[model samples]
Target chain A: MVFGADRECEFLSAPRPSTQETFSGQPLACLEVLGRTMVERTVQQFFQADVEFVTLLAPVALSHSLPSFRERNRALKVKLANDMPLAIGRTLNEYSRNGIDNCFVVSGNLYAETDLLDFFFFHREAMRPVSRAVDHDGPLDMWVVDTAKAMRFDGDQFSKDVNSYLIGGYVRRLDHPADLRGLINDALVGRCAMRPSGREAKPGIWIDSGAGIDRRARIVSPAYIGRGSRVHEDALITRSSSIERNCRIDCGTVIEDSSILANTSVGIWLDLRHAIACGDKLFSLAHGVAVEISDPSLLQPMANVVHAAPARGNLEVIEIEEENLFPLSTQEEAPARPKWQLGANLIQG
Target chain B: MRESSPVIVMEVPTILNDVEGQAFLQETQPLLEGGRPCLVLDCSHLQRVDSAGIEVLLHCMEDAMKRDGDVKLAAVSPACAALLELMRVDRVFEIFQTAQEAVQSFHTPAAIDAPVTLPWYSHPGGLDALKAAS
Candidate 1:
């Protein structure tokens, strides 16, 4: 059996950018990839490796807010730090005080699938104060450090003489939107360990729970329809594209090699190719430009939809505004009526 | 030999939405009606464009082709150029840096098929160079 149970190893995750500002130059790690956040996946990795505890260092602004992804480890703690380096240094000093010899210090802004137990054992065998992960590209921010020696760590950067552990597994630096798309495509094609969290309806096609895909909707292979998403009639999703949670792909809209992020509603009969859409903002990957469409009919945030609530007593005749009855959205909240409700309304009207 | 029609340069509006697109189409309708019409849409003032605006551009191009004529774009802003590229309409029109160059293109038969030189940012190494400098 693996020798990680008795070991008092811990994990310290540095502060990561909030996914809400993803298009505004934040790291892609916090953004929901496939069905889970990278932080959740990283925590799960530590939990699976029998790591004792995992602590997440969050920025002061994002201290109160946590991502929606579920963490497998209940021992995961969130600590606020105005300064990352000072926080990391203080945390390392505290760990040393607690008799915790060494801990895994992983960067929050990356998704790496290196064997944690192997890395731990390698660090011990190397007899170095610090061991950093390096791949074919270059050195990563991932490290295993001696808690005492790393007490005075220079922010997140390691000294030039630190030991290097060559990682033979997958690692993705979430620096750019193109890297995000590349990671998604790589995960879908089985180049990495990160798999879509859902049932594979067919070969190369993943459909998450509660996804309402019309029978007429054509979902070509190697595409993902995330949780609670909807794909309307004649909508074509092809070429390694992903319609993330709570998004609505309208009728006859062809999405090829693109990502329709959570809670977005695309207009009908439009062709979205090589793009990433979040609400009304569409970023073209091919052209390297982002535009915000002002027309609600063309594209709008799903949460911006105003619902007609039922009125009590006296029965005041409130006029109901016309809603776009076009089929499907890709996420959770169906505030007023589902697509079937629209069909019922159509019949009644 | 017949003398060619003079190139008509139409100024595009600031915001190219449905209303602006219809007005633009109406303004260029007379030019498209003429035989062998050479049109250049100057987009220096363009800031925003919707899908309908792109549709108007296509409609003008179709009308021009029907009358044995052509439509070219000139002085397209980066934002407009990006949108056109997104809609895959960049390949349909011949784009020029300035309206004068677009106007001169009509008279120069040899320069009609010349490829437009791409901006530095369009090159793969260009982004790396930019990043290095920054």
Candidate 2:
């Protein structure tokens, strides 16, 4: 069995490597790279090792529930807890009571390809309470813990100076937003085992099901268009770029070496190069700056556009199609003080 | 009447939002309207620039172009440079590493009007050789 921590709020900033919230407010592990999230891919790796049951511990409830994988695995449990140490301790105690000898405790904030079966064998041979996985860089946030012996110990104390298992596999610490883009580029170029979750339509171009690409739109090699996303006419997606799920690339826009996150709408006639665009926020890796675009004509969240309805009465509906209209109708709330209110108070006085 | 300087260098504000963009445009209005104005915008202090700021830059360029003048950028920060490159504004504006370099560039002719040498094929017998080969 595998018990992983998908701590969305507990992100680490690099250079110092201390706990800090991501500037985008989205955790790196939870962000999708090549159509698959890092946490999801980590969970799948454990399942491939013939693990019977898997439990995910998150600080807060996930906005979207993970796939249960009922047919592929025995059971999948997602639990919420504020205290990670206590949660891991309690879970290990439960596992030990159920007669489970050992369990893998993986920090889902990292993408590691360390062979779990090999790690398990190493842990068994060493006869230690825990075995921490290490690479050339140093110890990763992955450990194989002995549930019975570690039942009394918290998650932090369990892995302290434990048996170190050296791994020569791919490992990426998903700490910064730039690392997320790097992961996407690495996966596209075959530097890592992580591949795009879509079918390779051409030599290097991958297109998922339900993606609509106009005939005039050009997708050069090593690019991906995700499911339910639309590429408008004359749009150019090239140079290891990925347009994730349900995104819209408007006409004449060129995406070069960039990752457009899920549920984003890039406006017409724009050139996005070496950047990561999530919703209306665009982070340029080359310039090392993140900008929040206010104009819907340039970039905006797809959620806002998808749910927007035309205003009633002589507002003169700008666009007949719901998708074309700017995402402003829904954003404006009812005025706190109506113009008629002040006039009525004056008349009453 | 005061003689207009051959080249004008203007420093951009740190933050070029909507209000600042309007003020910047108003400041450059005279230089843009002056005949054949060569302006260099110093972007060394520019930290953030929004769409309104971009529009102001474009408007300044448009006015200069109408008056047979040009506007160039100098010492652009990476953030502002990326924003310009994203919007493809870099294609239109000539960017320089320093304001002095941008100012110096105005003195040097970008292109020569007259050809220095004739093509070898332009010789009298060159056409005869071409006709025979054809």
Candidate 3:
């Protein structure tokens, strides 16, 4: 089971970017590690360890707020971790009652590049109350817990034990904003176990299969462009930058050392550097400021095609006022009349 | 589709660049000028259309109108739809999902058995239908 805390980062002293601000309305688990979410990669780890099925425990708010999480978990036989606090005791009790003893509990916000099968086997031999993933720094909040022993104590036991044998290896806890940058950089450098979306066009650069970059677009690699994303003409993608799925970089935009989240639109002629652009809000790492861009030409939301398939080759882009597509009020409605009404009027005529 | 004797369905080329667009205009000019007032441009195969292509389509629409004829588009691909919308010329012409439907529309303005029951304006002929003569 994966545990997710929507807790504010203890690191950011003031003006802490909320979880929604940090992840474009997604929970921490939904943050892309390379191209995959932390939850998906964690589940992949469980399967690699030969552990079948999972119970993901997340805050109920997170469960409802993130539709993508629901989509990611839709395929697997894993049980939904509906409530964050109540689920731990309930899961342990259910396991104990069902005579299911050994189960792994992993934190959802981290990706550890360790051999999970080896760790699980070690935990099985040691037969401790719980054996967690640990390095010299301390416990990484990933562990194998025996349900019978877990049932004997409160939910706090999962957090209490650090004496569990150290499986000295690498782990990325994506709590701080800088740590997130580290994860992307690590993924780019081949230090992490994850893979980027596209074929390796050149060394240290990865582009997704469904994404597109115009011939005039300049990409100095050691970077990644996620699936379904588009880099328009004369756009510059350089210096370890990552642009996530379905995002559109308009013409003449320069992106340097930034992470543009999925479904965002970078308007034409803007310069985004050392920042994280999520939705309309851009958080600058250089100045430690987050500002919301209200200009549609500067930045917009790809609400319709955000979750769609890869970018189609040679598809023409329609440049219409977005309000024409979705009008909130009666007066500003689209000029295109409904077909039925048109037919009725035509027949009457 | 209707069994209308005078209505002719014409298929537009897939790629309507400048050359193809000009050719399309030349090919359709005779039919439009021959007192054939109702024409359907079947766009099921039309994958791409540029500014020149839209210009030619508009020209045919203009000629058809002078002869009391109308040019309707059918089965427009998303790429072509976007092109038309980008040019803000989508409202100028009648559009349908299938050539059969567009042809049948010439007979009865109301599509009785069509699956998509969206309300539409069949003819502007470059002006509002109610404000102008049919």
Candidate 4:
């Protein structure tokens, strides 16, 4: 049994926009590395593990507002209540009554590339009543509990602490933006040691499955694009840039050393450098400032820009003749500068 | 024109092409010498820029400022923008939204528009003219 903490029926029933919205001036959703919504990606990982009979526990009032909560599999159960501690306890009690022996609980905002069910099974085989998924970062991302060890009188926090193991990805709990960056960089450099089975491809550039890169688009090495990111024609991505899932980078835009969160659409000809965009909040590394993008269509989601289209739209659909930004004559002249004359002469002479 | 008045613009290309830093500087140097106190560079067309390209821009900026001129950047591509920001050089120069803006800044009220002309590189024609006069 897998229990997702933020997916109750009540949260799903409420009317909310599909795009991200700021709740009380706070960023409500977490954006994962490679442009995926943290919650959506976490749920998908659970499905990938093939664990049936999942249950979502959410606040009854919040359940009515969250759209992801409304869509559920018939096999998955959902329970709603005010207090998270009580709600989880009651669900475990109910599941125990139904003779379910083991349960898996995970936070909705975690990004893990590991197989969760296998991890849980390993814990069970060890005869551990409570197993926590503790990752390299030394905090727990998930908790697996044998129903037999669950105490009836024990509170929610205590149950979580006793049963949860630190598991999944390079780090267990991502507390800050820098932690997320560290996780991605470590995963790319092969320091994390968590590659999905198969002939391991070196991580200079790891393009996930289902990602589409246009032939005309240029992707330099050492970049990681998450699943479902579409790189349009003539766009450039280079130098330690991580584009999260479901992001639309328009044509003629360049992304370098920037983290564009999931579901954000960067306009054409815009320059985003050293910036962290989480939903509607944009943080500039140089300025040490954060701005809230209130309008999704007009750069809400983060950052606003007003500019003409980079390319002319030919509605008649004439034959397209793409021009190279840098011609061959120009490219050959870069290293020919006299400053490196000695080095070039030594090699040639 | 004065050799010190070099205008540097860092270009990060989005498409893979053969344009080199020397060619880029060569194309822009003529405009910089034509009484343009501030050199404006548009990097919107660029995609990928190597470390050599960055060094070229820095050299140009240093040269231009040495002769009492300024190199301004405009419409920097996102990749190049990030690189400059990462190197902390984006703060070193005035970055404008468009080349027109950077150019127009030269005509601002604070500018004196002093006609301080410098000697140009000794071309064959100029050297021949000087020899004939002597």
Candidate 5:
């Protein structure tokens, strides 16, 4: 279960700007990387290692977390919990109630591709209270422990400073969006165990099966656009960017070395470089600036974006081919810009 | 791509805001100084254009019209076109899909779609366009 506050949203700005009333607090766990969340990725690692009966805990309501994430394996379970204390308490209580001996405690906020089976067996054989994976940074907080014995029955506090076993493959504690940036670069360079969607459009670029890309758009090397995303005309996605599922890239925007989270719609005529866009909120991971875009015409949430018909003709196919042909279109015309409200700043960030 | 036909072609950068628009006017002032004012503004690379870009285009268009010539936009991106259309300036310029097509429009004067009915409240010389431009 993912129960840690080391990298939780404690000191960040208000999750929503005042202008938006319908904004829900979407956790970073739902921020899809290569079409998979950190939780989903961690769960997949366990499933791949032939580990059965896994349980997950998250901060958000189960509705927001479980819709798109009906896992491949049936043995996985999910629960709603707020922080590490509650999550740990719930996990141990449930395990104890079920008479389960040892359970794997995986943090939803962390992503590692270690030999999970080996780690479990290592913990089983070590005859210790817990056996956690330790990377160069420190303990990854993912370990196998006798839930009833190690955790307090009252379920309030447990010591995190435990001895760890170094069984490192590709471990990373996603403490910040900046940390995700390194993991993205690692995944792009083929260092990590994550997989891209569909076929590789080129050696480095990966476009999933159902992405919409305008013919006028230019995608440079080492980019990944997930399924059901739309890239509009004259848009430029270059230099190691990742756009997750069902996201929309409006006209004239340039995204370079950025990560656009799922179900988010990026606005027109903007430049995004070395950043992370979660929903309508933009965070310049490079500049440490976070701004909420209230204009729906600009950046907004569209969970139903995948259901809409994508742009057609040349952009119909997920053409991963490196072709920059500007095919002439008679239908081309300058559409109107969104009416700017009196004092609403065009580029807030 | 510079095309030195009877209709001179001037390339526009992707971003054409106030500063860049002013710089563009300065760079092209020499061409408009003494020669025939016929010009084709290539906007193939122009992904964005603000009100200042619109002002420059209209000013150059008026200057060309004063000299009995015209300015046409060629290969304007969807984004540039959208902003122009939103401000109702799309009707003011003779637009083409390609630079070659825009150049060819100079030979056939009947093909030009000059702005006949602009919104009376908004004129390039007036404060509305100026306010909108900023």
Candidate 6:
């Protein structure tokens, strides 16, 4: 009996004016994408789907001031209250008074694409509590309740104008800042689908299924490599790029169109175009400015440890400052010319 | 200030403030601090810029290079030249393509006209000169 969805959920109960008072007035209680804390990447995608006994309905003043959300959900089970549909209806009425009949209502800023969690456990074992995973505009990002049809769902029968159901993650209650860029471009373009493989596979690419890549990492097809992302040796991931989840694009970072959102750690001669890095800030979406790179060897935070250090000590300090200043074969080299000069006088005659 | 006078436009809007960056640096800081050498910056109703509107165009290019004046950026809006080449400061400004050729490069006189000899020469076997002109 594994139940989830409670990474200390307050999931923005709209008072507005707070994403640090509309972007960086400074007091962020969490919502950082590529450096953890979108409620710790939705509790590390529910502990990489091994989801056993999780509860977390948060807000007893953020479960007593988040000590790494109380030491990684120590054998989970939290139920603080104060409205989140009455704390997820009193934690689904205490998991339906312990008789726990199917439940997995996810969304702590939803980001689970674990191969769409086996198509949400095969549409919750073929429509159990009338399952869901719908997207391509049919909303519903994960839902598998059968607490006897959620005790006939009367928490105001959830309706933010429901057109095709399953609404958690405060459905569009992401308040402002253009609803957090339309909830991160509608969860990277699968439009609320529980996990239709985190959409985007072209026009600004976003591949995520088992994520590998390194037939010599060039990856330039628009670019975004989420779910289990990796791209070692010769990395380049060009224009309008994204590279989220379990990231690591070392060996020559050039990630252009830039977003690098989930669990980032890109090093090696980094170029990062357009930019948004997220967690430890670094935003510059063409200079809207944010920069707080607190050095983890310059832009760290993939929970640290990413060792690839050695451009042979920066090419031996540029070949010992070019052999103490231009000692290239006793430097006299300005001779081999002839690039293009036949009939060259075009105007200054 | 007479580049055959007619190009000192200035609408500037795609949202930039600080009273529109101090009213576009007080109406182009006195014709770019008097040398008035070539100043367009129209930006067909801009759309956004802040860092005090790119520090008033880097303070009108440092008050037009301390008065020898030279701030020619015209009609730029691809989101204001991608926020000035992502703040690499668009290679320190000077990008003209109109505003009457940036006020005719301040009164056109750097060696007036001399290069236009083209009576005709497009024949790298242009279909054998269009089959000997059909």
How well does each candidate superpose onto the true structure, as a TM-score?
Answer: 0.77, 0.77, 0.57, 0.49, 0.57, 0.29
Per-residue lDDT for A1-349 in model 3, tens only?
3222210000000111355324555555666645666675676666555454555544433433322321232223323343444556666777667656666677666667777656656776786777877777766767777777866656575667633757556677767565677778777877766766555657776766456667667777778877667788778888788998668998888888888877789877667777777777666666555555554555667773332122222211212122222111122212222321211221100
RMSD of each: 12.9, 13.9, 22.4, 16.9, 18.7, 24.8
Q: DockQ score for model 3, please? A: 0.01
The C-alpha stretches of model 2 lying farther than 4 A from their native spots are: A1-23, A61-74, A152-159, A304-349, B1-5, B13-20, B44-48, B97-101, B107-134
Range of the 10 consecutive residues with the lowest summed lDDT in candidate 6 chain A? A313-322
lDDT of 4 by residue, B27-96 (tens): 6566555443457667788666554566667766776676567888889755556555544568787888
After superposition, candidate 4 runs with Cα above 4 Å error? A1-50, A59-74, A78-80, A111-129, A135-141, A148-169, A184-216, A222-234, A244-252, A278-280, A285-289, A293-349, B1-89, B92-134
Q: Of models 1 and 2, which has the larger lDDT? A: 1
Residue-wise lDDT of candidate 5 within A156-235, one digit each (tens)?
A: 22335444778557776665667677787778778887766545756777766466676667777678877667788777
**Which of 1 and 6 is ahead in DockQ?**
1
* Candidate 6: docking tier: incorrect
Candidate no. 6 TM-score: 0.29
Model 5 reproduces what portion of true contacts?
A: 0.00
User: What tens digits encode model 1's per-residue C-alpha lDDT throughout A1-349?
Assistant: 2454333556545445654335633345555678776776787788888777777765554433334443223566656666667777877888888877778888766788878888888888899889989999998878888898887668544645688999988889876777778888999888998888776767778877667777667888788888778888888888889988778998888899998876789878777888888788888787677777776766777873222223322212222223322222233335434453222221100
Interface RMSD of each: 2.8, 1.6, 15.4, 10.7, 11.1, 9.7
**lDDT for model 1:** 0.73
| lDDT of model number 4 | 0.52
TM-score-better candidate, 2 vs 5: 2
Better of 1 and 2 by DockQ: 2
With candidate 6 superimposed using the best TM-score fit, by how many Å does residue B59's alpha carbon deviate from the native?
10
Model 2 error, position B87 (Å): 0.5
Model 3 chain A poorest ten-residue lDDT run: A6-15
* Interface quality of candidate 5 as DockQ: 0.02
State the C-alpha lDDT per candidate.
0.73, 0.71, 0.63, 0.52, 0.62, 0.50
What's the TM-score of chain A alone for every prediction? 0.81, 0.78, 0.76, 0.57, 0.73, 0.26
lDDT of 3 by residue, B17-48 (tens): 78899888888888887674789999989876
Name the TM-score of candidate 4: 0.49
Write down the TM-score of model 2's second chain. 0.80
All DockQ scores: 0.20, 0.52, 0.01, 0.04, 0.02, 0.01
TM-score of chain B, candidates 1 onward in order: 0.79, 0.80, 0.75, 0.61, 0.75, 0.27
Q: Across residues A1-349, which tens digit of lDDT does each residue of candidate 6 receive?
A: 2324421111222122244323332112244332233444455456666555565444443332221221234445434444556556556665667666555665443443434345445545565443544444455444556565565676445432222333333244333333444445555444653222344434445455445655555766544566556676676876536676667777666667666655667666556666656444456565455555443543555763221112221101111111221121122323222321112211111
lDDT of 1 by residue, B1-134 (tens): 34599888999999888999999899899989989889999999999998899999999999999987899999987667766765668889999999999998888765323323444567667878757855
